[model samples]
Target: MVKEQKKRFVLDTNVLLHEPLAIYSFKEHDVVIPMTVLEELDQIKDRKKDVSRDARVAIRTLENCVGDAPPDLLLQGVPLNHPNAPDESLGKLAIFPDHQVTFANPVNLPGDNNDNRIINAALYLQQQSSEQIVLVTKDINMRLKAKGAGLEKVEDYRTDQLVDDIQFLAKGFCELEGDIWSQVSKVSSEKVGRDTYHTLMRNELEEESFYQNQFVIDQGDDFCAQVKSVNDRQLVLKDLSRDRLMSYHAWGIHPKNIYQGMAMQALMDPEIDMVILTGPAGSGKTLLSLAAALEQVVEQRLYDKVIVTRNTPEIAESIGFLPGTEEEKMAPWLAAVTDTLEVLHKQDESPAGSLQYIMDKANIQFKSINFMRGRSIQNAFVLLDECQNLTPSQLKTIITRMGEGTKLVCSGNLAQIDSTYLTAVTSGLTYIVERFKEFDGSANVYLNGVVRSRLAKFAEQEL
Candidate 1:
């Protein structure tokens, strides 16, 4: 019996930008980087943006793969090692067009487009190679063009996707069994302001293996508590319904919806180092995160300053030559940031001209994602809004920047991704919610309610 030939994968540029180590994802299969894609990466490598940074890293990784290897290896292949895609002998990575192969562009696409060139390279490989050849890209249009050009083997890279289906993603809460409430009341014994809590038997639901800081809410009744701590035969439960956090207003704002209420509880808990709020437009994801951040920074003095950053939309390929510095370039993009602050001020009922002082007192400063690569943030509250557009790799970069005594809130509407490549199931918010499900001090909420205004709610539901 003859053994089957290994498959070949030709990766698109966006896939590399989204995950710098994507070459290793093709297990036991050959990986190909079109020379055109390399040139595109080189064109944007100097920009101060996450995608550009990823492009440079990928270029370096490719170079390292070629280090000390004979010139023939560039056309043949080099071994790759990645823990996530571990198969030591799985496959090899190489640069496509080690010798030029002739191919034509899709008639509808411009000949000068980089995407068409990449697709043409894939076409050459498909015609020349006996093994299966696939074009892996995140761009929907690129996929369409590849298919139209008769390249049947094309797919989006799924290595970073945590879940296969959108419905399979956790909604950040679980329904509690009826008897557990009584069991909860038995071990109940803690108070914070007007709130009451309990510590249930850890073994009571040990088989379920509930995640830390997970909300156990029952719409049928008022029994709501978070898994405060999980130890042998004893699990600490903190009340969510009767907690003082729900009734407390933050910077003259209160949680108007149940989802917002849960978000506030997680934010106010010092034990929780990270909180994620996922919701649609007008669902108050930004407003709730802002209120919680201000309350912690100004009222509780939990942090010295609030660092607010508006991550660039994924559409930008490079930062280019803006006339001003980082902050000045980022200022125009921070309209949403300032608008949220104004709403918080008006909610506070502050007199005219008091809003500016409130903002200065809170010590809010805008930080651009361009310069956030190597900084450590301590004793501060960081808000990354519009995070749905961020790739999983970019999100990881920001999360690693958190230092001691720092809390980060990632707010986004997963349904409204602006990036041409990202989908609801493949977004960074989705990745974090699923990847951190079992980790302690990390909580997430799915806010489906729209409570901003009647008109806004109507648009959200009808439009």
Candidate 2:
């Protein structure tokens, strides 16, 4: 009896950008590239700002691997007829010689696009040879279509798997053991006020406490953390000067809706020097952080100014040059900040006058992360938006910029990260949240259930 040969697989264009190294993912199996895939790569060859350029480079690298090989050995260009019955050039390359390979365009039987052509080629090859064929794609719709078209196997490019069992530390409490609790109790009576004491009590589980916002430090074997409740009463943390802590408050901000109470409690902390907010898009991470900064700067006068900056290291492509001055260049990125400010202005009694007054007072400064290299931010409310895009090195640079008496809040959506080198599990936001989990001076919050338009939320889930 003869042994059956293993199946071959063909990849689509989008799969490569979604995962650049997908070409090498298949092991000990034959890989085929229909000629149409090369044409798609050529169309995106000159795209400088998009990941398409990276896809082009990947294809070029593969081409170099096949350099000067015999036509049959290389699976070089093959002729295939399109649905329009025109002979078109499609490159064919054999990744494995022991397996039989053939390429031909299938009949354009309804709902056929460039991707369909590639699938049809695979189908034709499967029928011609004894080996089965599988289609790999990142396009969900394309995958479904390929299945409906009678392809035996279809799979997504899964190189970008998120870390399993990942949990955010936003809304939970910690516990401490007896020894750790005794140590904390001793320090609680020092410069810390009553609200801080109570918050620590609420976060303390036996002997453990939730420190900062993100960390639940082990207080030895006997302690744990617990969340505090105020019986419908919101608690505000008083400043060291015995003044009410002020925060940016505005309507239509989603975090204000879900995280307002927690924000209030966090701001009351005298020990927490940094806070991190992570959520999906429209979850109000940035707006809430800004609100807290504004309150500290304008109302409490705790900070000299509010400094807002973002690093566009990931989405730097197609950001385009800003017309006119540097401020104009920054306007597009600062649009969200302006929108939040406008909302705050509308809530004020004298919208125009109050905005101008705040501007004149130098209470708010919008700057780029590039300009933050040599600066030490002291006695200010500093906000870093879109921090998920920052590489770990870049994030470290931003965090180290904090000067004495300064409070820093870094906010970004882990799911919406555009950085090719990072994912929700490995992004700087996750790294910070995990690393700072034990620090009493830091806090982390993850906002779920986006408060954007009803349709937007639906699209997020459905899409």
Error of 1 at 234 (Å): 8.7
Kindly report which residue stretches of model 2 are placed more than 4 angstroms away from their true locations once superposed: 1-9, 24-32, 47-112, 128-132, 163-258, 261-283, 292-322, 329-334, 344-444, 448-463
**lDDT (tens digit, per residue) of candidate 2 on 1-463:** 9754565778787666544445555544566776677677777666644455457656765665466677776663322222232353332335332223234454333423577677776666666667778788867788887788777788765544433435633333332334554544322232354434233333323422333343232434422222322222221122221112223242323233324434544543545688777767776666677666666676667789888778674334534554555455666787888787777679888887877787656468777776686788889888888888765545776789899998888888776787755666657677677676556577666666666678878877888
lDDT of 1 by residue, 57-165 (tens): 8898788776777768877877776655454666888787623655454333345778888887787777777889999999988899899988879999899999999
For every model shown, what is its TM-score relative to the native structure? 0.85, 0.51
Lowest summed lDDT window (length 10), candidate 2: 234-243
Judge candidate 2 at residue 278 and give its lDDT.
74
Whole-model lDDT per candidate: 0.79, 0.59
